[model samples]
Target: MKKLPVNCPSCEKSLVVSQLSCSNCETVISGSYSLPILLQLSSEDQDFIFEFILSSGSLKKIAIKLGKSYPTVRNKLDDIIERISQLQKS
Candidate 1:
């Protein structure tokens, strides 16, 4: 089966699913669905998050793998943290 498009094209953001349909009965259900705040972040931020997770939250390793200075890695991490907090609140 083909997967449906699940992200915004222009911003590359994820789309929240809030509706379901019953094929046999032709019944449809809908509700409010909010996209996670993290999806509002830039693609770079998302990549940083993935890398951070893969590196097991090790700043030194992340910095080296990303070929960025330690301070840069730290700064990126800080930005990601702020985003996460905002996401949690929303």
Candidate 2:
């Protein structure tokens, strides 16, 4: 499946979910819905989150898997955490 776009291509503004349809019943629903905070993150960030989960939230394991120094991985995670906090506030 194609990744969901979080921004408008032309204006670069964040995009909202405006419509959804049920595949089973063909029932359509329409409304302006804000994208979840996580979905609003870049794909790379999302992949990091998936990796973090799969590693059972172990920074050491994540660092090993990414072939990165432990401090670098920790900084990356810290940055993600800050981004999430800001997103939540907005």
Candidate 3:
């Protein structure tokens, strides 16, 4: 399945979920809803988070899996944490 876009193509602004539907009942609902902070991240970052979880939050394991230095992986995770914090405050 294709991932849902979190930003507008032209304006480069955040996008909201305006409509949703039930596949089973064909029921539909519409409203303006902001994407969750985590979902607002780029797909690559989301995948990193997934990997981090899968590795049991081990930076060394993640670094090894990505073939990167442990400090590099740690820095990347730190950056993601900061981004999430900023997103939460907005």
The per-residue C-alpha lDDT of model 1 at residue 60 equals 95
lDDT of 2 by residue, 4-78 (tens): 899899999889999999999999999999999999998989999999999999999999999999999999988
Q: Please, what are the lDDT tens digits per residue for candidate 3 over residues 31-61?
A: 9989999999989899999999999999999
Ranking by TM-score: 3, 2, 1
Task: Quantify all predictions' global Cα lDDT against the true fold.
Answer: 0.80, 0.94, 0.94
User: TM-score, each model?
Assistant: 0.60, 0.91, 0.93
- Candidate 1: clashing pairs of residues: none
- On TM-score, the candidate that comes out on top is 3
Model 3 has an lDDT value of 0.94
Worst 10 residues of 3 by lDDT: 81-90
lDDT of 2: 0.94
lDDT, model 1, position 87: 66
Candidate 1: tens digits of C-alpha lDDT, residues 1-90? 444554778896567768979999999999867666666666778778889889998989999998999999999888778877876875
